[model samples]
Target: MKAYRMLTEDEVLQLKSQSCLADDWNNVLVSSDFNTAYVHHTRFSGNVKLGSFDGEFTLKGGIKKHAGLRHVTLHNVTVGDCCCIENIQNYIANYEIGDHTFIENVDIILVDGLSKFGNGVEVAVLNETGGREVLINDKLSAHQAYILALYRHRPELINRIKEITDFYSNKHASDKGAIGSHVMIVNTGSIKNVRIGDYCYIEGTCRLKNGSINSNADAPVHIGYGVICEDFIISSGSHVDDGTMLSRCFVGQACQLGHNYSASDSLFFSNCQGENGEACAIFAGPFTVTHHKSTLLIAGMFSFMNAGSGSNQSNHMYKLGPIHQGTLERGAKTTSDSYILWPARVGAFSLVMGRHVNHADTSNLPFSYLIEQGNTTYLVPGVNLRSVGTIRDAQKWPKRDKRKDPNKLDYINYNLLSPYTIQKMFKGREILKELKRVSGETSEIYSFQSAKIKNSSLNKGIGFYEIAIQKFLGNSIIKRLEGVDFKSCEEIRARLKPDTEIGLGEWVDVSGLIAPKSEVDKLLDGIENGDINRLDEMNTSFETMHQNYYTYEWTWAYNKIQEFYKLNSDEITVQDIINIVNQWKEAVIGLDKMVYADAKKEFSLSSMTGFGADGSREEKEQDFEQVRGVFESNPFVTAVLKHIDDKTVLGNELINRIGHLA
Candidate 1:
């Protein structure tokens, strides 16, 4: 870390003779031992400084380039020695170039005026009509944006957030830009008013203006050919390449945007991926992915969602502009060609299929399906609980986290069944019962939330939700009992009791982090009171909530169990516990068997059609076996079998432990 020093009269004379002109030669500064030999074929104007760059850089393809100035013009710039800067079509101005930086074949790199590198840029996310604008910054998190965009009813809080962002922007505003050490910029077009960080690699990029590439040695950013970015802040470990266009956006850590993806007025949080798709006014939370060309996500807020090919949403009716915004809670998915009208809310882990025009709202029914059949929106609630895809998604999310940076901005929870969805199940069960009571028990179709639920489906949904609740509560109890040798029933009851009252009410997923509603409200109250002012403080709250999720969940689950089984936990006997364990064992095994059956569908005759194209019956069978493998040997199938075995053994063990009291 060398400190900049003032230039002496003799060195200023030599620089003047070298055709470097400054407003005042005294304004041009240098390090104490700046070398005059490194400044060559470069014209400097305005106040400038120079540093000793005594270093060599090797290009990606083994092209050796020395550090020195050549064929460039600078204004109010500081050029370090041992840096190779050449062929700038326009002048490089108001910049401090760091040592050993390799710059070649760039059209221009300049700070035209005072700028903050895209901070405080208002991104009209979720609603294009602009009521919910998120102030973009280098450190913006999904939770902060969620509050700013969705909590407009609290105008004072929103104003406070806006003021905080404005303060950050003003504090960061500077007339001079900075390019960090070991940066490589080659074959890039105009780069104006953007700050480049250390070890960044920019090649063949088209226009980049009013942005900050927050790259570093630990997590460098790579901007590749034909990309055009404006009004953006790209975070560390991200790759923006292959003709992608971004405007008014923040690409968070370890995200991938390439293959002609275009985004505007959107905020993509940690580990998101967008390729060959278009997103507008979307708040894409962690792991929100759209990789198909036909997928167009607009005016929606989502997290941990996978948009299938041809998935589209309609935000505007003919009367109004695209003012409507929708929310698909975490782990939601849309099938191919599925369409959702905005102003709708779909629940977590639910699947949307077909073009639904009924404007259905199923936020209380997680793990369900909204399917349009013959223009009728049919709801199959809670059926997704046994789906193999749902299980696989839960199993894969933690392993697939793309963020490798040590300093993760967003704290993500990947649980499929948290208090968030479990509370929804409680509501879903009640909703189904209310539907059954209002309609005749024998009615063929019952209507709820703009969707039709058949008599059988409604009853089955209630059953499914109950089973899921049992499983979750059973899991919580077993976990609480783990490593504990309970000698008395009172001790067992104490161990199973919740540690906190926070989990007694509903829960919500703040993007990828799931927590109790009371906890989220506490965070909101803190924000309103200006207690949580910084982004780091907000994220810390979310992390704290995530870490305490299980404690809160037990509170909720313990209260629900008395209502579910008609036996209060304080009065529950050993026989009651045995009954609950037996029910849980059945539910777990039944769900696993359903999943196994569903996975077997992949090996059916219909699934083998394309695999054995040119083969006879025996050959086709052999080909299918060779390519798809036997269903019995599939990894998921084996896991399902193991799960059944493990659950049975555990249930028997628990039953025997309480058998004496029984």
Candidate 2:
């Protein structure tokens, strides 16, 4: 609400004397504090408004420059107070520059006609051949895009989401662009139809067109040298630097894409890091990191994934266009030089090694490994449940989150064993038991989904899945009865009952948020029926689900307890609870011992081969200890031992408490 008035005749003359020219002096309006002494060597046209330039800016080396317009051309622009606009190679047109900003050595910044600032751009993510186009807007979240891309079967729901996005885009369409306060745009080229936010730093960027940098004071964005971006919306706390190129993309909060990484028609959600890699039409969910120069991720949907060096995927068989796509569920990892033919689905927390041509689907067998030998795909199920690397990955993801914005777009769940993976393990156990029953228990190998599982692996998988299931269910029961003072068997049974029925049946991982499938369906129904019309309301619904996760999880676990233990909820007694608690104690101790054993392999003799080069065996052992620490004293090993001790005490305490009720 700044007031502007025409400059006095003497002020106009003084400005002219200071080497400033205007098409018509009457068209230029200035604030009360505007001084002719600070305005020099500038040309003004097309109804320009100038604010007070009464302050000076201090440089890094204690140099001071008075805030004013110098050696620049402005057309239909309003320059705010304390801003220094200097050395513009071409005119800045139709922009409202904010206070305390510095724009120097820029070429041609403008808003042409009416622009939506990339709000309505359709990003063809997940499937490269199109159809799964998420209309990316400023408020787009990973969970929203997940539904839009993969829930194509619900056409009405898709149309509703598109309508909401289109409405948002149209509402924000403007004829004039804006640069917020405290922004610095230096040595940039051709910024057209872009809206830059507060505290943003843009330096040496080649071109940025039709985008919105949603930066703020709390979480500023930095776009650095040689970066070229088009039709994108980069959220707060992100850094795009070092010759990176992106087109038709929506980068979420705290993401980093740099070092010549190139992406086209993709959606990268929160905390995703891509350095020196190329991605095309991929839906990179939260924490999908690819740091290799030779790795190419295309036509895939991934979350909490890590792609190793030289890892690649094929999107076509060469007969048709590149129409195939694949999904690697959360926490899946690919080893170096690994390859997977598209139209496949790898389960959650699975490790992939070598190359495989067959389209194997291991969605029911999580925490496993898919290794290739002599071109044959071998499935080792539930082995990753005991891997030290898997535990470390689970422990590190939450610590690695870099989003500083208070309003995070993506809702991430960091639990390694939730209802989502536990359900898969439950099905995996059933599938293994069925295989053993059908193939005479003595079969050499069992074939499933074009992959082979040896008899030993199958039996071991059953045992592993059972242990994990017991652990999860036991955890739920113990937590449910944590502070309850149940003195009788009836009170224990009453306490064991679920509070709600919302978590029965199946659950899904919507990007990172894990919730019941029934609830997700209800949300989709609301969207389809026009009950949920705004983007904010949809995000609010997701937040509600995230907030009530434990409540819903207890319901699912309650139902599974009855089925797994063959008990009726009303007729259950304290003796049944004690038996379940005893089994849980054994499961917890068994898994911890397995993890301890797996961690010991890292310090084995074979792992010390490359250590202590140019030394004898004793020296090699010494060097390995110096570099990697002793096996008994390593941090992860200590944590594992502590976990074992804590869980053992917890199980015994719970068992003793339940025994008193009997």
Candidate 3:
């Protein structure tokens, strides 16, 4: 807060000579060190405060501009030291422009009446109807939005959370907006009732109204050419540009929305990307991406998912409103030109191809393929477990996290094989077995959930689920006994006990944070009972859950061990450990082999058809090898091979260590 003094008569006279005008000289206040030379052709109205202009800005291409006010109208505005404001088509009113900031060629920057700057804006996510609205705030995380959108049955809980959000919003509601220090607003249009943060860069933005650009020096927000945002909160480390338009949206940390993407009533969380597409009433959780022009993601809930070119969904039945929605759970992907009629649920890590209106609910069957044949949805369960693409996706999500803010808003878990999906496999195995039993074993096709599963796919699915389940159980047990040397069966049992007691019963993937459903229920219960009263408190709870995920996962895994391995904890022996280790080796090695083979398919002769445009067969092979590389030397194939060797050695070492007890 710099001290300001009234302009002396002589200084006012000099300002008049410099073509600067003030409605009343007495109403204008300036810093003691303010220079009249830097103030030129600027008109001031109402009560205005001006800071000293004593510096210069060196911009791109060696262009230099002295810090000053020129050709601009200031109405009840306070200009900080060393700032430049010029070429405003309309006046900047009721704004406190910060130090060293630059504003040029902007239409207007002002606050009218009172505003919360996009806070508490209800984004009607996952449902086109108004019921499942999420009040998007600056601190809105994916998990919080998940609860607000999905747990609509709990009215009291929703009311309490909404009230909390409203209170937080009202706390920041102000009659005067602020443009933070070191900010740049160039070639922009209107910025009304908006708050711009420190180090933000706004260039060529058409209209920004009733929004908060929560940028900071740590992770500056960038709004590039032809962007239009209304009723939005663009979080730190995000980039919105290239003719993108957003309405009633919350763009979370490090997200990118560009290439003429348009979104309305949507909530996009950390690391989500939208380009050349449209999203309506969608909850795009962490890492959700859609990168094609014809893609329309409407009335859906997605996380760690991708929408291929021309992918679309329809929710309206033409009878009722667009009330139906769908969930493409974590790590789901749709192929090019694929379509789904909503109110369906695709399992985690599943792949969708072709068009389907059957509304198959494959939520219990993770890692499956929903292929359409003659408009029939053919559910091939658990086959994606061996797809090289799935492994690559799982490995890349963590590496691709774009959040640069030290203060992260979302706590993302990138694990592909947590208890969440494993439990689904456990249930999926049962579902497939039940399907096989109810339908005769010799049946050609099994009809389940409006989709048909061929007998071969069903049997293969059961086998796939069994292998994955055994792998998870074995991996968990090995991890439990990783560093410990057990002398007796009692010691082994004690070591295998869970580190915590919270993760029991059902587990859920709350957006990206996988945890026991009981624990999430506990958090919800807290919110309903008024114990958790603040947004930060909810975030803290999620961070706690994220931090202690492995501990909670082990607890869930321990409880499942009894049912999976048929082990009696009290009477377990070293031979049982040996048996599990042997099974683990087979499952791990066999899965790796499948993935390796899948990777080879990409480097096959058929895949290299177009590599060499004009060449002989040998030249074509050479060109293909140069472009795609040999399959054996590919990074993913090498990784898979290494994983097989590593897991084989790991199981053998464990067996050798525990063989002493026998």
Per-model clash counts, in order, read: 4, 0, 0
Of candidates 2 and 1, the better by TM-score = 2
List all candidate RMSDs to the true structure: 2.2, 1.4, 1.2
Model 1 lDDT per residue over 1-662, tens place: 76777777787678667765566766667787777766666776788777775766777789776677767887888776567888888889899887678899899899987999999999999888899999988778777888898889999889888887888888889999999987889999999999999889999999999999999888999999999999999999999999999999999999999999999999999889999999999999999999999999999999989999999998999787898889898889999999998889998899999988877789999898999999888999999998999999999888888776787788788877777788889899999998888887999999996899988888989988988888887776666666656688887777777777778777777777777778888888887898977766777888788778777777887887777789777887777778888888988988889899989898889888877678688888999999878889999899999999999998888878767766
> Which window of 10 residues has the lowest lDDT sum in candidate 2?
653-662
Instruction: Give the per-residue lDDT digits (tens) of candidate 2, residues 476-516.
Output: 99999887667888777777778888999999999999999
For candidate 3, give the lDDT. Answer: 0.92
RMSD of 1: 2.2
For candidate 1, the per-residue lDDT at 594 reads 86
Put down candidate 3 lDDT per residue, 311-394, tens digits, no spaces.
999988888979999999999999999999988999999999999898889999999999999999999999999999999999
Error of 1 at 207 (Å): 0.9
Kindly report which residue stretches of model 3 are placed more than 4 angstroms away from their true locations once superposed: none
